[model samples]
Target chain A: MEHYNMNLTLKVWRQKNASDSGKFETYPVKNISSEMSFLEMIDVLNEELISEGKDPIAFDHDCREGICGACSMYINGRPHGPWHANTTCQLHMRAYKDGDTVVIEPWRANSFPVIKDLVVDRSAFDRIIQAGGYISVNTGNAVDANAIAINKDNADAAFAAAACIGCGACVAACKNSSALLFVSAKVSHLALLPQGNPERKTRAMNMVAQMDKEGFGSCTNTGACEAVCPKEISIENIARLNREYMMAGASADK
Target chain B: MKWSELFTSSIGKKWVMALTGLFLIIFLIVHAGINACIWANDGGVMFNKAAHFMGSTVVIRIAEIGLFLGIFLHIIQGLMLEFQNRSKRKKGYEVPMGNKGSKWYSRSMGLLGTILLLFFILHWWHFWVPARFIGHEELTEIEINGVHMHNMYNLMQYTFQELWVVIAYVIACISLCWHLIHGFQSAFRTVGVSNSKYMALIQNVGIGYSIIISLAFAMMPVSMYLGWV
Candidate 1:
């Protein structure tokens, strides 16, 4: 719990654009505070780069609190650095020591093409959400929470699935770049609720169709996604997704 | 969803792998059971009877076609999945995260399947082709209770006599062990057995089944080669 200062070497990925062949560029940071977050360390390094008249690194980060799912980039081979159930924004420099070298790179996947230095286009996730990751709810006053009368276990599981922050860490961690963890989380979050009953079948079917159309790879159940998930989403949702999709295929009217 | 999409969709394709994989899992039990008859040691009379029954019975003969089809679909879909999955990551990581996320064998299904495929081809050539075709010249003819049959026991004995063949078989079984260790629970997971209560059970069963089946298979060749039977 003691704070300390450390000097570190960073090998960061740099690319002009999606079409540009990216390469790693190394930078040296002096006296970084252990109490600073990983992104804060990057911010310090960026400021120094700007002072040196070099183009500062471009990375995606919205909430430094780790909820927005924007903070991404593989730090030393792991998705969000060497922490369990943690994100980049929550990763502190304290995890490292003096004179350690860290290699950072953007998510590597055909579906997630790199847009710039340490940033990839993750709109594929948006499209998959658009493909039935919702329920048909009438616009009106907020419904009473007690009206649903959901099972406690189902509600808990649904909440767990809902914890997914739409981060591409699952896909980034996956060797196949499969988005099943993300898709399954979305599907299970809704599918487990009674409000999600009407379009459950179509939701499962259509979302998967869109997932495949987006050129994401099929899942091989390697548990890599669950391992690197920032929110610690379980692959159990993937099994639920598979079950939902199959049942929908078997009985859907259309 | 169109019926065609049943096999075309990503989940659909996984369903195929799981169903076919489960079928093959069952087939392994039958195979190991029949092969265990070698322990009867009555000069392979029991083993030969079981092999002859499997080869000659009308019901089983028809089922054999289904078995081959199951294996064929499992292999083809496995290859397609592998190739497609590989293309998803066109760019390789600068620093590899080897076995940090999952076990090596879980991520190496393609490699293990390829090894198993090569082994199967040799296995079929050694036993299946001759038992099914190539006439009786290659197989010794024997009669049990007036029921004449090809002596597959002799073929197994003869084929395993060579050290290379025994070693190859054992290596293949080791690969089979690794494959089943992942595939068994994976098949259950694919079929939607996501309940936390059953997950641990399935995982433990998968590991035990993989070891037992593969060990039984590996021992067959070893036993034959060493003249233990």
Candidate 2:
């Protein structure tokens, strides 16, 4: 790729805390390299702000390589910029050109309130996981890895669903602000395996109940969540989740 | 899970949508088939007989009640879901991402449903109210094979004669087309048919169903108004 430099304007959201009504503030950066990651470009802008005796824009980021699911910027009206199946940190500044204006905002959902500039409290996801995102463990001896014989296709799909990084992108991208994709991914990740079978019914029931209690909206099958997910979490998992929930609801003793 | 959760929970709400949506899908097929009777072009003989049978039978009458109930449940639950979903996002984005993440119709179900509701009101006023309440005293009473019934085919002809009504029905059918295009596969997905093989088949079948049903409906009015029937 040919390296180039460009000047750009960024309109970023600024919020003091959860209670504060946020607004966008624009700033210009000069001579930004196209090779820099989107987060690195923001770092340069932040350094400039700090030098000018201003509050630097605070955004969440870790493992800039894209696995951590920490970076959650809604860049240019997309959860992770315009790239398909890419994370915000992995997005390159080359996606833009000279004199371009980029708009960046945090994930906007009632359940995930904005804690500060570009960082919303995503612990709601944590609570949902706490509800039932686990399988029972026997504390004594380590079991053989080959003990559980799994089918190859289901194992691959389970692996794919497990790749969801707990990012709030699916919620951010959904028109309803629904967390179904996240919950479904979590559900499918475990439900496909025999180890996850014992708790499967309660897991689906409780997680969905917790998700609803968090005030997240219901799924409308709009496909937006699948489109914006950085981990390429398939909406097929959502259907599987629905199947699990329905069967559990119908047959579970509780 | 408790039985009440089927009505009160989020996934439960989706089950309601899926079930009611499927019911309505079946209703549309029946409705479109009946409407296609207009193409028989037999001077309203066969059309009025079918319409009379649908209106007068006891079992069909019971089923009509269920149909209305299904429609009401679909509408009420749909609107409530739309409102709850809207409230989940307190603040709006400055730059709207229009149709990049999902198709416009999928996102605009609420708006399309509202339009369909309005069309339903007009349609009921024009056809159903007169047929059910006012009796054949208002419509021209005619007999076919010793069976006397309301001349509903004449009423349809009269209703479609107005250029504005024809246009409105065409627009409503267009909206229904888009609504069903998204709704058909979505209903199946909600009902747990997420396997890739079946989903591919459902998606194609859904597209065909939407186009064919809406076209059949739209043609009823267009052909009547243009004297093609």
Candidate 3:
């Protein structure tokens, strides 16, 4: 791909700590390559900050590859920049014009508090998952993947649900601050498989309880999460979560 | 109420929201069908009779109770879910601004729902309660083909005569339609039909159904005020 030299301006969020007052700070970069990924551009800016005697802007990233989902950013008015099914680390500078002004900030929600510039602690997701994501399979029990022989349809559905990377993008994207997409993905992923059957009742009950405890808003099904999701996880998973929950409630009565 | 249980437990308030939302979808379908009868040109006799049957003492009482429960459950569940979502972000993450993946409606459900709730109260007070308890005095008596008829048409026309009422009704109808488009398929999905093949069909059906219902309902008042019916 041919790379074009581009000039850019960034209005980035800056916070010293969680309790510190935060604000947007503008920075200018000259002659950036259009082929550069969004995070790589940020790397160039951090070098500029450090050399100029300023603290490097803090942000999260693990695998520069999209699979890790470590880089989370809202570019312009979009999550993970403008590319569909693309994470921030994978979004190329080519998507923008030569002298574009990009507004970047941390995900805004009462549930997500900013730890530093462009980084908010996302451990709420970990708490939600720990609530009851997995079935109690013994470590020593080595069951073959084909041993259960799940139907092709169910397996596909389960895999799709499992594709969720526990990214808080859905929550950030929702106006209600609802985590239905994330929670539902977890519920549907397990609910679709046979191994999840043994703890289905407890799983549904526990996960939903954990969801409420975490302070996530209820889903009104506006489908914004599915639209912004890098994985394009569907709202149907939420419905399945509801079904699993209701069935669990019914069976618990017996 | 335990912190661990609320975040970790699966069969809690989230399920309540999903279940109540599904029930309301059923109610909306029945309501839209009833309102559509106003367009039939039978001197409004069929519509009046149907309305009367629905307003009968026993049926009215049952419906009143059900409506109360449905609205109550929906609102309570909604508030609880909102609280839970807020609590989770006590500590924030380092993410950027502007979520392009989300839609306008998804973020505005709270506002839409609040408007719809206000409209529901006014609707009940203006038509439902008055027709049942106050005995439809707003309607005039007319002679139609040697038969004595009640001018329910005139009553409807008069209600829509005020520009504010018409405006409010129009706004409410739009909000209701928006809510239905998301709520309809969502209710289905919550019941566990997330299959890709079927979901696309459901989403389309949901959108079409909401548009048809909103237009059908809005036309009745507009047409009545314009003296077309």
Give candidate 1 misplaced runs (Cα > 4 Å).
B136-138
Please tell me the TM-score of chain A for candidate 1.
0.98
Per-residue lDDT tens digits for candidate 2, residues B1-229, read 6799855798888988889999999999988887778778789887888888798879999999999999999999999999999999999787777787799999989999989999999999999998878653437888899988888888888888999999999999999999999999999999899899999999999999999999999989999999997
Best by DockQ: 2
**Candidate 3 C-alpha error for residue A238, in Å:** 1.9
lDDT of 3 by residue, A80-184 (tens): 878888788889999887889988877766667788888877788888788888887779878777777888988888899899997688887776677778988
Task: Tell me the tens digit of each residue's lDDT in model 3 across B1-229.
Answer: 3443333343345455557777777777777777667778775766665555565568777886887797898886665655555554554434433334545665556667889889988887777666545647686666655655455556676788877787788899899898777777766765677577898898899899889878877777787777777
Calculate DockQ per candidate and list them.
Answer: 0.82, 0.83, 0.40
Segments in model 2 whose C-alpha atoms lie over 4 Å from true places: B136-138
lDDT of 1 at A137: 88
Better of 2 and 3 by lDDT: 2
For each prediction in turn, the share of the native Cα contacts (below 8 Å between chains A and B) that it retains comes to 0.74, 0.78, 0.53
- What are the TM values for chain B, all candidates? 0.97, 0.97, 0.81
All models: lDDT? 0.92, 0.92, 0.75
* lDDT, model 3, position A91: 90
Provide the TM-score for each candidate, comma-separated.
0.98, 0.98, 0.85
- By TM-score, how accurate is candidate 2? 0.98
